[model samples]
Target: MASASTANRWLRPEVYPLFAAVGVAVGICGFQLVRNICINPEVRVSKEGRSAGVLENYAEGEKYAEHGLRKFLRTRAPEIMPSINRFFADPK
Candidate 1:
């Protein structure tokens, strides 16, 4: 057993160069990951209303954000239903 252990002694952790090379490779990969993330821009959205309406990139405000907004009613789902206690407006 002693002879076998002595033969495998080269695999001992006293090998500093192997460990140093592995550490340097990991450190370089980590640095590259951080550098790539920092170089990318973060996405930001500006909301101007309560609807889940997606804003048009060129329009700054909610009203003009969606195309054909002049034709569509821009009310929430609850408001679209008639009020039970009050006179309802014509659906048209």
Candidate 2:
């Protein structure tokens, strides 16, 4: 048996951040697992398809392993705060 205060301690505002952090971590891990299962050639389940050569498999693995978002961003500037970056980068 536990006291009401002891049970209520877990619901305090101070515990909310920990809960949020855990939720985010779980979500990220789940997404990665699903992505790998779906696209990572080594882990992806193959159906009846045309047999591929070794070179083709390697090329496909590289393409499928890269997330679409990462591929899209690869050509773009890595800027978290674009406005601030431009302001600081500009010569007076």
Candidate 3:
């Protein structure tokens, strides 16, 4: 009778790839199941509301940054607009 180690050694190496393939398929299925359960669309509205509230809390900061960017672009428009117009006018 073969020893345990010898029996294991006798197993074909080709079986390893089959086992790995099965493991990957099972892992993918488990990940998809977990993602579906955690992010079901029924709770999307609540998630969006929470994210919106967070954004609202920083509204003043965003508004100031937006105004600064707009002012900076307005001041630089003469320098930037010509290049942009030239680039778009003819791709070739």
Candidate 4:
């Protein structure tokens, strides 16, 4: 059988990317879960006063109905590499 030192070798630098990928995936899922529970009008449940249907809160829900990032980016153009594009486009 292999020694304990050899077993510990499994945690090498090569595994860092996999770890980062998993961390990002977990973080994204967690963020979506929290956003849905807190900001999503349809998924959210209110404990204040009488609970209303999704349609009842239409005007009030309009604020958080769309994701903040999405709303902000909606009016912006997509830029893959703004710096690089600017550098090449410069006349200087």
User: TM-score for each prediction?
Assistant: 0.31, 0.71, 0.35, 0.64
Which portions of model 4 miss their true places by more than 4 Å? 1-9, 44-54
- Write down the lDDT of every candidate, Cα atoms only: 0.56, 0.79, 0.65, 0.77
Please give, for residues 1-92, the per-residue lDDT of candidate 2 as tens digits: 48887879898999999999999999999998998777676663555332442334777877875768889999988899999999999998
Pairs clashing within candidate 2: none
Any runs in candidate 3 off by more than 4 Å, and if so which? 1-11, 42-92
Residues 1-92 of candidate 3 have per-residue lDDT tens digits of 45887768746696788888989999999986775555533223565555654343355455544665587777674654797798988688
Cα lDDT tens digits for candidate 1, 50-75 = 25464454433443334363445555
Span of ten consecutive residues with least summed lDDT in model 1: 39-48
The best candidate by TM-score is: 2
Pairs in steric clash, model 1: none
What are the runs in model 1 whose C-alpha is more than 4 Å off? Answer: 1-14, 41-92
Better of 2 and 4 by TM-score: 2
**Clash count in backbone of candidate 3:** 0
Instruction: Please tell me which model should have the higher lDDT, number 1 or number 3.
Output: 3
